[model samples]
Target: MSQVSLVAARIAALQQAGSALALLQATQELASCADASAAPVLVEVLGFNNPGAAVAAVKGLISLGPAAVEALLQLDPVNYGARAWAVRALAGIGDVRGLELLLDALGSDVAASVRRAAAKGLGQLQLDELPPDQKQDVQGQCLGALLAATSDGEWVVRYAVAVGLELLAAGLPAGSPERQQAQQGLLTLQEAADGTPPVVQRRAKLALSRLELQ
Candidate 1:
């Protein structure tokens, strides 16, 4: 089949609620085609309203290695939501180049959702696994960003920042100051957790438990 047709077919399958693993495979295949023309299709499918589809798309893009970065980068933060998921996939792929991109997005992006995704991506990147000094730097950067976001007028932004902080704490050393600080942030989030979405609340709880602070 032609590249265009193949790409369209895959996207249609995704929209039809195809298997997550299959969609992920197609995402990588489409990304590897190196055809920017297929970007819109991939983005549309990747940005499915369903979180499951979104997660699969990100995983697929990550599997494409570096070639998917440019396509992933071109997605609009507000309209697509792919930018946020892209950061996650990139980080999961273990590419540190995404580190700078994620930081920039979290610090400057207008969309709270995107910024939240970036923050969570940083945690998934295992920034805490870096050398102590490097880990400190990354943690400091995220903390500063989260602090600012928490003060934003948007409740969603506040919640997102809280989630990011909680995730960051997961990999910290036992009884470390950073872990303690993150636990405090999670506690601050607890009061409003009931009002937030169940998934968000669950994530906060998981992160808190990971730190043994629950």
Candidate 2:
């Protein structure tokens, strides 16, 4: 059968699945197809209560890359679970189109997991693909968000902030102001004595060490 026909059949099977196991199997099959045409259906699967199916859909969307951005952006804002999954997919894809969403999620989302994903996504964004001026601007914005997230109450989120700062700094030119700022952010995390978790402190120390080597 043609690829389109097969994708359609897989989508039909996913939609018709009556049991959780069946849904996961169908979702996995559709996701493995990696057809851009399946993006919308894959996105819809994010809203399902099935974590396995959602994970498969996220992988499928990541494979679709920029083509999946629109559908991910169109997800219902009220569906926090779906939007969280979309954030992960967007982060994995690293498309610049999801920049604003990632920024917002990192800065304000109530879920630590979502915030952590967004922090990492901001660092992982494909800024090198943009013109020099635009890349600088976006990088600055990403740096600002990540630095601000360093104070997150959750140790896990703060750990992610350390990672994000390191990655963002690696993309910046050495001796640049943004790079300095990222390094300072890492130092603050590493030196914090206000009950910072040992893991977070170690992560920041490790990130700072890596940045020094770059």
Candidate 3:
């Protein structure tokens, strides 16, 4: 069998293990594998009460990338807190399927941590790695979302937005409109710096300093 098949087999056994610790170990091992087949299993584990296993499972799903994104969308966690974790996981993957969810979470009544994760997740997308045709559309969507997020109620969410803008801008050239828009967003943050929390001010300032040099 191929490498992914072997990993699939190992993960199957680990999934059926009698203990959370054993499942945790399996998740750690899965994180190192590039198999997309493991995504659904990892998605289920995100709700596991064992923090370590849940975290490891999330990381593993992220490593699985777009394939894992498919599995994440099909999830409907009965536990409200599990839904938060699912949102956070979707954000981390930064897949297009998760984009709308992140955008909504940014403006929702959900936990601040979930909103913050959404901002960070958009920043983590590998847009530059996509094909030329797809990259443009994705960039536009991500930029619009990030720009809108600058007005979020929580300073933490705004801080993540600023950081995410910096990351998105980093992959573009100075003359590019997207890059310019990101810089403009940072300027908005700067103008409102005094009203924002200290942590957000620091992040906006740092992002501005970096953009100034870009």
lDDT of each: 0.64, 0.92, 0.78
By TM-score, the candidates rank as 2, 3, 1
- What TM-score does candidate 1 reach? 0.57
Candidate 1 stretches with Cα past 4 Å from truth are: 1-57, 65-88, 91-94, 192-206
Tens-digit lDDT track for model 1 on 1-214?
Answer: 9877877775665556467666666666555565545555655665755576576556556656656566666666676465666666665554445777777877777777677667666665555347779878877766666655555555566566666776677666768887777777776665454355555556566667766743
Cα shift from native, residue 54, model 1 (Å):
9.2
Candidate 1 has an lDDT of 0.64
On residues 112-214, what C-alpha lDDT tens digit does candidate 2 reach at each position?
9999999888988987779999999999999999988888899899988988888889999999989999999999999966978889889999998888888
Alpha carbon deviation, residue 1, candidate 2 (Å) = 0.9
Question: Which is the winner by TM-score between candidate 2 and candidate 3?
Answer: 2
Please report the candidate that would top TM-score against the real structure.
Answer: 2
Query: Can you write out model 3's per-residue Cα lDDT over 107-193, one digit (the tens) per residue?
Result: 673688888887877776766567887887877777888898898888888888988888888877788888889888888886755
- In model 2, the clashing pairs are none
Sorted on lDDT, highest at the top, how do the candidates line up?
2, 3, 1
